[model samples]
Target: MNIVVILAPFSLALALIGLAAFWWTLRNDQYEDPQGDASRILIEDPEDRPL
Candidate 1:
């Protein structure tokens, strides 16, 4: 169908774009701290200075 023909390329392009973005994020260490934030919340804050 004409719709399929038109949509297939668009879908493929979107998939390729997504893959490229994922690879770029990995290369730049975008996901390296997945648990760091969660663990930070459990840490106690240091004593506060007197006002």
Candidate 2:
């Protein structure tokens, strides 16, 4: 009863904060190179080895 009244607004605020952060990331192109990073791991850089 009383606990729900207090907890509901708190939970909703947290959810809104999370949504804002996700929206900010989208506007910043944070996920643009998702596949690039994954595929890059499989690539070997020749310069990394010493002759």
Candidate 3:
């Protein structure tokens, strides 16, 4: 019963931190090229190969 008091606020704070991080990513356009990276691997570029 005493643990709940400590855990509840801790859990809420953790969730808020996670939400803040997600919001930061959205504002920074971190998700803009989601598909680009996935499809880019299918192409072969000379720059990516070792000389």
- Name the top lDDT candidate: 3
Write model 2 residue lDDT over 1-51, tens digit each, in one string: 999999999999999999999999999999999899899878889986569
RMSD of 1: 5.2
lDDT of 1: 0.89
lDDT of each: 0.89, 0.94, 0.95
Candidate 2 lDDT at 20 equals 100
Show where candidate 2 strays beyond 4 Å.
46-51
Worst 10 residues of 2 by lDDT: 41-50
Q: Report the lDDT tens digits of candidate 1 across residue range 1-51.
A: 999999999999999999999999999999889799789777776753344
On TM-score, the candidate that comes out on top is 3
- lDDT by residue for model 3 over 1-51, one digit each (tens)? 999999999999999999999999999999999799899888898898878
Residue 14: error of model 3 in Å? 0.3
